[model samples]
Target chain A: MLSVTPQHFLILSFLLVGIGFLGLLIRRNVLLMLMSLELMLNGINVALLTFSRVGSNLDGGIFVFFIMTVAAAEVAVGLALLVALYKKRNSVLSDDMGLLKN
Target chain B: MNAVDLLFWLFAVLSVGGGLSMVFSRHPVSAAMFMIVSLVGVAALFVLLESFFLAILQVLVYAGAVMVLFLFIIMLLDVGPEAGKGKLSHFKTGIFGLLATVLLVGILLTLGNSYDSLALDQSIWPELSESKDGASHSLPFSTKVSSFGYGLMTKYMLPIQVSGFMLLAAMVGVIILSKKTPDREDLK
Candidate 1:
């Protein structure tokens, strides 16, 4: 009989983080990068919930709740920025936006 | 393996596979869809962990609101697949892949031996049988939703209010940034 433990959850979280990180590095599209960022946050949220379960601490859960709020706000702001960038340049590629480049 | 373990494996595979697909997908819309799949799987995992409130919130906020925002932006911009720079230069992609693999291996090695030692601190975690408010309780299990509400109203009140403010600020910021105006100074 196989039993899932906190370690199993931890491993899963780590794998998710790795995938998100790799995607962030390899993807050039700003939208895909934002999605990867969300994936990474979701991974961290899983870890927080696992810890909350193991510790029997509602604090971890509360923390994740706050994280969700922050993540929502982040995505809102990020998408707004992406929209602004697209309007300015008519392209969403990170390479195409060299506005910061001197 | 019992039904729970089987379900765990299923959702775990769904999440990881969806994430991988999101990464490899050529089109932004496909990547957005894959992200939804992954987010739903994470919500399922949250359910299995018995954090029903968090699970519901995960589905509501992430799968519902966030994904909708993502799709909205994707549609609004009409962004296409990343202009073919070979998806990524082979050398850089290989380097990132290698780094991620090394990071995963390091984490596994560290957790392999010490995972057991990472047990919950008994003092901080009250048992289900423990009494609250100097009265004995007969609840067989913790009521997470009530407890969560209590904690938010009491201990975490400040941060909760602050988060609300932050969300409001972001909302205003997004409206200002995205809306077109005749005299929009920031756009110029």
Candidate 2:
């Protein structure tokens, strides 16, 4: 309990991902869902860093850098889509955007 | 009981607690704030791992730029706490939550079972070797910014270029998505 190991970091990563997944499952607001997505990505980042440290591999760090780049791009595109959706529907709830459900 | 252990636990609690609060928070703005807290905590963990460069990048990109973008959107949309209250049935949400919980538990259990195999030999850290021309120069991995730069500019060059292109595409896409389409009257 006192000593920190790779396992502890891995567990933390899993917990973060789990919480994010729970949020994604339950949340209806698109923005909240996006936030949860970020949380999940962060969790993955933790795992990657841990592996990088344990193996002394720089590839993991490189992967993380790319992940961050991709994440930023995703958020930009996602939020823009969200704005367009709001403009059209006047609501950000996923339930309201189901125009094809009928 | 050691400083590393204490710091790990402190930041772990901070990050996990921030995540929980972000998920459960009633307001989108507050949720974003909590996410910033969580990102900062994760940055601290990066520092603990001795990846100072990545830690700073996490703070600058995630906690700084990405979060500001989130807040800007929140304000632009004028979203309120009411936006969070969905009309979805509780039964469906409950079922989904249960399924998610089950999946999480399964993954954690698998991880726990494989925990022994994941143990690291602290003494043996890989020292990457780069062979140029005839000479093979060995580079021991250290959490240094210079090393990251070297790797990015050399081995990971293609991926970085691809990432740059993707970012440009995203920028163009966002502009197009958010642009006001000229109505028939405006066209006339």
Candidate 3:
């Protein structure tokens, strides 16, 4: 087996995260922003598995499973909310969801 | 390169490319579909990393379940390609993109040369042949499954319970927040 290094995994994770950040910053559409969030979460999962493999603990992998479930639930709820917002405003721009006043 | 390394490189390329396309694509449904491809590649990469449990979870959760939700929303919203295209925000977003790219390249280089051995540590070194071969000290055939079951049920049960609550909370929150406003419906 060709050995996979933690650093290699780190590089991949960083790429995914950077792209996600870029997507979040540049995209006007809320749905696209959510897609970018998934990219960022997957990047974190990759880092977790890399640690799990290198550290010889099953805990990181287990944590990733939880993270995945959380992410799934988050997507479901976020989209439903997005759909509702679209009904009100006829748009899904990040700037338009002004429900929370600070 | 060994087979595992080769597979890793292949899937990594596929994932990264698919992910970029997903982000930049103008069509909402295509973006969601490309995201699924990116997810599948990540799952394949997980398998290469020797975490069988994680790989399966990735396939079933992110690729299968999450994508379905995303697709459902895209279809429901009718945010097709025509809906996605629009006027640009400002040139500042371009600057931010440039900054992000440079920072990412910097991180990649800082990690430096995957050729280094420090990347491999004692923990990851393949299980010592002696340990796996030691039949006397190792687990027996029938006990392996039961032992794993007990370990998960006992040692790492908290996460399982938390995930259930998280789902419930998210579902209720989404429902409450999305309810139609009486005024808006009356106006229509």
**Best candidate, DockQ-wise?**
2
Kindly list the per-residue Cα lDDT of model 1 for residues B123-173, writing each as its tens digit.
Answer: 212355444652222112344588777777877778989988888899899
**Cα RMSDs, all models:** 3.9, 3.2, 4.8
How good is the docking of model 3, as DockQ? 0.55
Candidate 1 regions with alpha-carbon error over 4 angstroms: B86-88, B118-129, B133-141, B184-188
Give stretches of model 3 more than 4 Å off: A1-3, A98-102, B82-90, B113-117, B121-125, B128-151, B179-188
**Candidate 3 on B53-130: residue-level lDDT in tens?**
677778888887888888878887887663524456457767888888898888788777544754655433345232
Instruction: Please name the candidate that would achieve the greatest lDDT relative to the true structure.
Output: 2
Indicate whether candidate 1 or candidate 2 has the larger lDDT. Answer: 2
Instruction: Give the better candidate number (1 or 3) by TM-score.
Output: 1
Tens digits of per-residue lDDT, candidate 2, A1-102, equal: 436778888999999999999999888889999999999999999999888877766678878899999999999999999998887789988889987897
Point out the higher-scoring one by DockQ: 1 or 3.
Answer: 1
Report, for every candidate in turn, its global Cα lDDT versus the true structure: 0.83, 0.87, 0.76
Q: lDDT score of model 1?
A: 0.83
lDDT of 3 at B8: 79
| Model 2 Cα lDDT, one tens digit per residue, B1-188 | 77788999999999999999999898999999999999999999989877899999999999999999999999999888854355777899899989988988998898989877766555223344443332223233467698788888877778999999999999999998888886822542
Name the top TM-score candidate. 2
